[model samples]
Target: MTKKILGVFVIAFFMAAFVLFAEDAPLAPSPDAKGDNFLLAADFRNAFAEYRKLLLENVNSPLSEYYFAKCVSVMGSSGGAINPEQLLDIEKINPKNAILAANLLRLKTGSFLKQGRVADAERVADEMGFVKDWLIIGPFDNATKAGYKKVFPPETEFHTDKTYEGKNGKNTWRQLSVRPPFGTIYFSNLFRADSYVAAYAAVFIRAEKEQPVAFRTCSSGPLKIWLNDRLIAGIEAYRECDFDQDCTAGRLKPGWNKLLVKICQKDGEWEAALRITAPDGGRVEGIVLQNNIDIIKKEILPAYIPDDSDTQIDADSGAVGYFSKLIENNPDDHFALAGLAFMYDFKKILDENDKTVSNNARKALEKNPGNDFYRYLAGTCDEDRNKRLEALLQLSGKNPPSAMALFKLSELYSSTGGGNSGRRRAVSANEAEDITKTFSVPMPFREEEFLNAALKQNPDFVQASLALVGIYNRRGTPWSLEAEKISKRLLTLAPENPVIVRLTYDDDLHTTAENAGHYAKLLAVDYTDGNARNYCIYYLKQAGRKDEVLKEYRAFLQLNPFASSIYQRMADYYEGCDEYEESIACLNKALETNPEDIAAFEELGNYYLILKDIPKAQENWEKALAVKPNLPDITEHLEALKPKEKKFWEGIAANPVVYAAEALADTEVPLHASAVNCLKNEIIKINPNGTSSTFSQQVVKVFDEKASMNINTYP
Candidate 1:
């Protein structure tokens, strides 16, 4: 009994000590000692819960509130709800805790920016003194190891000297007048150049004091940087340039500072843009810079436009004048004819394009009658069955005929109730789209046998496998297992190639969320494919899992920031869910990505109209008109909402005679005039008072507007 009492006293003493320690201990900065690893791991819900608990324990603790706000920001990054009350509370508690307040504001600013609230974001950013302008230089030749050192010279004077040009093609500094959130610029814009042009950019900045500033830059190629004449940060290889891709903190001096960037380009695009701010990504007032020279040039060499000839093609007809001249000079100019044929085909001028295609095919056949490729081309271009059959016979008769020849032969055979090895089989709808040929009578040719023969010729032929997958998927036959296996193998063999994903999806391999997720994972392996990523998201959304859609798009945007269309998708998704506010925000963001996007403006106009903001809708449509005039629908919509038109509607109810006179004057939208006429006839028959006639006219107008609303369609 004495020993048990002593043991109880010992346990009570230990528990008392623990309680005292817990009471005295300060709150942890995050759930984990290091920080919120949950957020880093993308477990936002749990992280949010942990932060909530911390805030509850110490309600007024600024750090806890700041972290909690971050959790909110992360959760709401993809159009989730934001608690304005909580954010405003953080604003109220500022100056008492400067760091915490700044962080809270930055989070608020980001939220505003994401939602396309540029005015709100700029207001916050201005309060913070964010750097919005800089002077830039370069796109020099940095293709070699020796070229690299020349970009960032070892000499200190290299930065201080305005006249200094390095051993390679580095040039003097030039002024770049722009703000953050801009798209990648082409090197060809500044000066005429080939595909693989490299350059260096330098900026001279002045700050009021020595302080840490948030530094960010985007480049469409490999980039290296030196700030204050010292190496700061860099991305060593080619990447899609975007805001905050290589974002970091760097120190600015009390006076003059130099920032040098070396961007190495291989092809596609060549340019960079920079942004600087406070450590919290807020504005920094009094940051300034000036340069005498602006290297920007207005000329964009016509040769630089993708697939366009230096000589102008007929824009209206999509005809290549240069290729036409080349063929005119020499009737047997097969290459020139083929080029024109391809251009026409790309423009979808099929009738004209097909004639050129047939001409080229004929010329190629004349050049080499034994060439299976030429024979196949002739077969493909010709619509007549007899002529196509003649080309196919020639193609098949060649020694070691190509896989393409066999595939084409199979497609023709499958169109008209063909069997495996001439054994008759039933036609399926799944096979219809793949087979270009059609016939009333059954053709005794085995489509599968021809396909198998092609596979035997080249076992690793991707096209053959894709064709087979399509047939198997559509038919839902026992061959589906084989199709699945082949798809899996193709994905592995050509992991870097995007064709596998396209073929797999085309074959309906990603029918379920689980299977679609597999494809998303595959696409995630490479950073190049935004369309493939979107394709997977489409299937995932179709599977009734829309919650994951925003998350996936946010993740994709993080990697491919220049894919402005993804923002459009997010806006569409939000709009469909009846989240008009979020949709509006996304449309604003889309404008930031591509300011000239007419579709985004049109959509924004429609959203405002839905919200009953007629003036705002008109403003957006006017902006769209400024970008592209002669949009009949926009013109019609504007006519109805005009202040003059609105007055007529109100006056029609107030003074029927005056309103009817005004309505008859307007001629746009025949339907509107018809409705007005019908209303006038009713008003005349009744011989009602002015007010009653006006009321009746107004009623008809409402019905007419409602009818138009029912048929809502916008580009």
Candidate 2:
């Protein structure tokens, strides 16, 4: 009975196993189901939808929330706008996901800022604690009334309306507002200079009942302010954003106080605005309405004038013509003549053949010998033409009258060996140092002191200014402090002079606009001045202005039409700009100018190679080699082109039968035998040299003993 039970169990197990093996088994299909095939197929909509569904259905999945946020951030709002509530929901789902939250906030804040809804944007920023950290205000409305009411109240009364005179005079009456706490005020006007004028426009702040009010006003040009007819702050020269002169007078009384602003734009455009923030850090407002009308008429009206002279100075042709006319009218005007002479000198330096107007400057001076200006002009011409000693002799007379002439003489002397060997050697050792000391000593010395005597008589001398700055720079002093002081003075005198502009802006000591202005100041000058122009172009390129670089390079080439390497440089520039065909054309032009140019051949060959024209590459390489054969690198490259052969062994057996037959064959055979016999004998002769020899056996002794030493040596 037990045996019968065991048999029955075995039969049942086999039947169950058979059924299980026949049926299909269950497997995980989730990987394929959730795969990125939809993304690969570029069906972003479907992929996004599926991802969202997965996140909702599998909230516990670690990667679900992350991917869902990524998709939402990338897709953004397709229709009206993304609902803030939905975003808030995502944030709550994964609060630790900072990047996603930050991106979403940025987009929302950017949209708000663009619409000028600063209040709403600030509210959101407050919630995110980003109010103080991330904000860029300004390009604000700068009208005078806008600044006043924003800071004070309409009921506030002024002490005097008759501060100055005119239609929009300083005596004009207006209401002022109480001051706001803890905020900065930005004031501006349209005067040629930046000085303040009491007139139609001013700031009036309403004071709190007992709170002390403080403020600051910094100007780049000139500015002034008053509180209830009381002078508070004043500045002569403008310094934008400076903290020194731009401060409030003191605390103010509460209830109806007036503030007046007298601003001017002497040289350029002007406008002003104020930023008022309460001490409690709650209230913040910018540019409010006011009653001052003349501020707009006088200080601000000139800014709007269509015929303002300052604007004309910035216009390209106008600026060029302005200098040109100055030179034309006052042919012997030292400054004007010097300016014009330098302009032409620049061109001459760039292109020696361009004598144009510059060549006549010296003649103008000769026409007016009493005009001390001609001396510098003649000296400059001589110096530019490489007559250094002659220039020094003409300018450095015993009765030197101008600091510029003396400075030029000093430069020439220092540059041209300073007289004989001993003196020259001594000067060379401390030449830069001596020049600095001599130039920095200021003006007014004995007749024997050439530079000082000349400069003392002519303090406004441009040459003296240039000399002072140059000398200070070469002295190797710490931080170039002396040079900076002199340069600033020079800039104030001639703000638009190219040389002064370059010196002020190009120093290692200055890396910001506050330190100086943009390098554009340099470019604004004439490019005919070779040293200044080249330096300008170099700085522009360093500043990453590639378009300007190409333009300047083109101008340089125009000035130097016959310079040989310029064509190649232009070609390189074209190639950098991805103008391959232009590069090829330039190279062709270069070859036309100089057919024997090996560099052109090499460059052209490279161009063709890039185009994959191997035959053309070979052609140029061959041409280059033909001109200068045995050129080391080219010879090796040519040799590399030769065909190579596959190596093989000569005497190895090919088949086992051949080897076995050779082992059974005889030792000796005749010279001329039947073809079959020769084959057999040749195999047998292999053993005749040595039957007992293995492949590694010493064959030299066997050959000497049996192979016959008398056999012919030559094959």
Candidate 3:
């Protein structure tokens, strides 16, 4: 009784303290506050004081120690207080709360070396279970928490539900039907069942409640969620556990939202659950419906129980012998037959050189006539041999072919069949009509009838919408208008999607500039899309904003080091602006990656030529010509340099006569006929005075006669 009374008093004291503190405390400034603001906001000093009091009241409380350590570390001048040794001592107690333990350990180990406690810090850091080799520092208060925020943005919410299947004719998991309208929740593989799958769905509220909204989603295993008819998220089976806690935080407009969740069990039993919470303190525990609790039971289907024998074959190998034996015992087993057929087809594809496997698959089809599975196997064999016609003939009889069959037909028609002239026009016209009606669709819709059928089944299919965009973009009358309409609708569905951004901003710079000018006139406009910004820059450049282009390019380069083309473009702009040295520098860097880049070399050569660096120009031109001797302007450049080379030789040749004359005077062996004849021939060849060649030849004859006499005297 006394212990109970003490516990009650402690609870009352804690409640009163919380109330008093809440009343007195100022609202927290932004979590991003730094320096003095950091010290003042998040109430570091008050947190410290309260933690100190808590420590005094309950000396053994791990929570108090953890918070106290955090407060002390955060409140310290620059580098955190409570060094590695001190934190290590606290972590030794091993607090049960994982989050608190993680936070305390993060703060201590993050700066252990910078605090001049290297050896001790390393030991403590290892003890605290820091796994990653590299330490990343940030401006935020807590790096891990800041990282979480970076990955999962704040002010987001999620909703999801759990599902289960019956095992041995007993309900495995009770269906919780109450689902919340808005909230945040952390979902995990709680039951550890093979078929266990969970989802966290959140709708991000945009500023204008009426504006159309978008959502982002993250899922575990094979999961998919759709907003309206557009798929927002999907994960394939056997993928890594993506810790996407805040995946869905995009702008969501106020309206009716529909979400469909499907999870299939490849192996073992299926079990799952969800937790729903809201950013605004609204909470829904488990899956519960406020109205008509019994109605949900009726709405929900009985849990799906997959037959154990219906096992999938390995993509790499055939089904195991045991499964094959099962098929042998039960010859009419569709699952085993399909599995074996798929395995045979896969192995045949792997060994395409072997024609025997395809023959075997054909035999399987003959034995199991009228079997869709065998027909599919035959089609697969035909597809491997590039015989699409045969595959199509095999699959054509079935009304509403399986997804796999349809996929194959789509590939064949898109790539090869449509290339035939007669078939091309028919397919193009059909595609055009389907696109005209749907305003969107996936690619390779194959037959127009197929697309029409798809639209009939799901009127708002986004693949249909996209396909319409492509068709109109390619062939519609008034192409731009149709494309723009589809792009606008796609933007409403996936505003932040890069493809949509590229599509909507597809027009030339002039159009974008005109749009920007019009948008500027509108009141309270927010035209801050990144694609729009890029388009604006493009238009501004067209409007002769050379300086702005340089500035933006530099800023862009700083952010994106791999933007080599941007650097090259910026260099061209600099050259245009008469900044030759800067241009050369930029071109040189580009050449580092693409050493044989003729364009860059040519540009650099031109820059050098402009600066009157003839030698540098010659060097760069030589480099350019070496890479591509037959480059368009290079032949002309080489021809132009021929005279320069001739001029250089002429200068050297001018003094050659003087050397020859001196050699004649010095030698005992006379510079007789040969020397005189060589000199006269050179005079004729040079024709320095532009004299007639006949006059030059006469002069050469006179010299030759004189040389003959001189030689006679020497003899």
Off by over 4 Å in 3: 1-411, 417-446, 478-487, 498-537, 551-564, 625-715
lDDT of candidate 2 over 1-715, digit per residue (tens): 9999999999999999988975544322322133233332223345456655665554443233334443453243121122333433554564333323433453455445434354554455443321121011111112442332232221133323334232221222332221211122222211111232212344434444534333334333444455555555554442233222232433344443445554433323343323222321123233233334454445433432111111111111111233467667876444444444544443221222344444555655554444333444566565263443343344444253334455555555445444433132223436444444544433222222444444565554444556666655765575378778777777765665656766776456655332222544443433344565556556665566677767766655444333336678878877777687788887776654344456777777667655546577667767767656677655543432332221121232322223223323533432222333323323322332233223212221122322332222212
> Residue 319 deviation, candidate 3, in Å?
17
| Residue 238 C-alpha lDDT in model 1 | 55
Question: Per TM-score, what order, best first?
Answer: 1, 3, 2
| lDDT of candidate model 3 versus the reference | 0.41
Q: Tell me each candidate's TM-score.
A: 0.35, 0.31, 0.34
Which candidate number would show the highest TM-score if scored against the true structure? 1
After TM-score superposition, what is the CA distance of residue 135 in candidate 1 from its true location, in Å?
17
True-vs-predicted CA distance for residue 186, candidate 1, Å: 11
Q: State the lDDT of candidate 3 residue by residue for 582-691, as single tens digits.
A: 99999887665345567778877767766757578778888888755677676544444333222322232222233244444554555556646555444424333333
Evaluate model 1: give its lDDT.
0.54
